[model samples]
Target: MVEDRRLAVLRAIVEDYVRTEEPVGSRAVVERHGLNVSPATVRNDMAALEEEGLIAQPHTSAGRVPTDKGYRMFVDRLTTLKPMSGAERRAISTFLDGAVDLDDVVQRSVRLLSQLTRQVAVVQYPTLTRSTVRHVELVTLTPTRLLVVLILSTGRVEQRVVELSRSELPDADALAGGGGPEVSAGDEPARVVDAVVADLRPRLLGAVVGKRIAEAGAALADLPAAVPDASRTLVRRVAEVLGEAMSDHHADERIAVGGAANLARYGDSFDSAVRPLLEALEEHVVLLKLLGEATAGGAVTVRIGTEGPYHQLASTSVVATGYGPAEAPATLGIVGPTRMDYPGTMVAVRSVARYVSRILDDA
Candidate 1:
């Protein structure tokens, strides 16, 4: 009973401190919380909590504030997540679902999270490797040039123009019943390129879009051979470009940030907490490392003061989670001072991640 009572006292102190940004005295805790105890009992509990290094007196005669360890205890005590209100969830969905593309989804997520949490928000885009092939379009830009457009399930499109020549493509004169690289009937090259594209589109669509590519190497070995002799070079070059595009992506390092100006709210601790974190946000490497700590499950992680990889910003705290359909999907979260609202911030971070995940996965 004593331990439970002390925990209750600690919880009240943490909540009051976060809300007021001032040291919490025993009388204030008794007045604000329905702990059903006298000020004397609360003071004794506070003393016990301070003995355990959970709360501390900032001045010789001031009220107590929670320590880093205290914040960890407060966060851990949340046995179950606090669900956001229906209106908040609806607001998130309505705002995020309006995104026009994958990039817009990321940008909106960062903005919404920052607005909701009133803290710096960072969102990492899901990598291309996690996306499946949606569609591929081959456009005949010219007799010797083809436009390769690859679409992914994430609503992302990659386009590359591949230059072909008689060396790689069939000679125009050959298609015209002549044997040379010389231009024949104006429409011969166009007809030949279009035919090859028409044939290759179905073949590539049948393949996944990854390193194995528009046609995994093993599946594509016979592709060139399967096509007509005149289209072999065109098929080979188109497949090669797609293979390169599928493997050419890096989102782990790509981050969209917002609400950095919110750090100024730290007031007295602005120099100690806000300044360092603001500078650190510029170095995406640091933000990536912090967000990397967030796990794939919906579990919201809170890394408070010194618990994170960078100890230099000990006054900063991170509340983050991973988003996307993959096992190692990208991450998104908020960064703020330890004195911020933990419960509210955790809910905001988690809600934003879920909606963003839904948008990316269902796109």
Candidate 2:
């Protein structure tokens, strides 16, 4: 019972400190929270908490504030995740509903997280290797040129241009039909390219549909052999280019960061933690590593102070979670000072992550 009371005292102190950004005294805890105990009892609990290194008096005679270890304890002991308000939920839905594509969804997610958490937000694009192919579109730009668009289940799109030649399209002249007056030089290219797309679309889709990018590329490797002699060379070029596009994963591994200005709210604390964090945000690899290091259980993960490797971020905290289909996970999270509202921030991160997952699932 005594230990429980000390924990309760620590919880009150952490909450009060986060809210007020000041040391929490025993009198203030009793006044603000009806602990059903005298100030003397609370002070004894505070002394015990300080002895345990959970709370500390910064000044010789000041009230106590939570340490990094204390924040970890608070996070671990949190039993219930605070739910976002109805208005907040409505805002998330409304704000995210208009995203037109994966890029827009990522951009909106970063902005929405930053706005909700009042902290810098970082979102990693969906990992393409885990994503299945959605569609393969072959657009006939010209008789010698085709545009290969590789669309993924994650809503990411990659495009590459394949070049064909008269030699590749031995049937080019045949497609022009004896150079009829109606089939001008310019018109002949269009006619042949259209024929190429019509022949390749279904075949290309068959090779890539429902497969991961790398797997789809492997499946497509043999597509040139399947093409009829009429367009073998042209089809071979298209297949080669499509394979290249599928293997391209640079965009999939990217990270988008927003709300660096929010770091300015740290005020004089900027030099201590906010500055390096801003630099790290610019280096997306750092942010990706930060989110990558987050717990992998799809639950909200909080890394407080030096719990993270970057000593420069010792005064900062990270709250993050994974989004997207369970098969293909992506990370999103908020960065803020250790003095943040942990319960509220965790709820916001979890809510946004869930909504992002829903959006991707719907996509």
| lDDT score at residue 270, model 2, on the 0-100 scale | 48
lDDT of 1: 0.80
Against the unseen true structure, what C-alpha lDDT does each candidate score? 0.80, 0.81
lDDT of 1 at 171: 49
In candidate 1, list every pair of residues with a backbone clash.
none
* lDDT for model 2: 0.81
C-alpha TM-score for every candidate: 0.86, 0.89
Across residues 140-188, which tens digit of lDDT does each residue of candidate 1 receive? 8887888988777656678899998766766444555443222345556
Q: What are the per-model numbers of colliding residue pairs?
A: 0, 0
Per-residue CA lDDT of model 2 for 1-363, tens digit only, reads 998888899999999998888899989999998898999999999998989999999998899999999999999999998688899899999898888788899999999889888999999888778889988888877777778887788877778988866767646544444432123234455676676678678888888899877788788878877755556677778888877776767465588888888888778844688778877877877787777544323788899998886888789898999888655678899888999999998898888888877877787
Model 2: residues with Cα > 4 Å off, grouped in runs: 141-147, 159-189, 250-252, 293-297
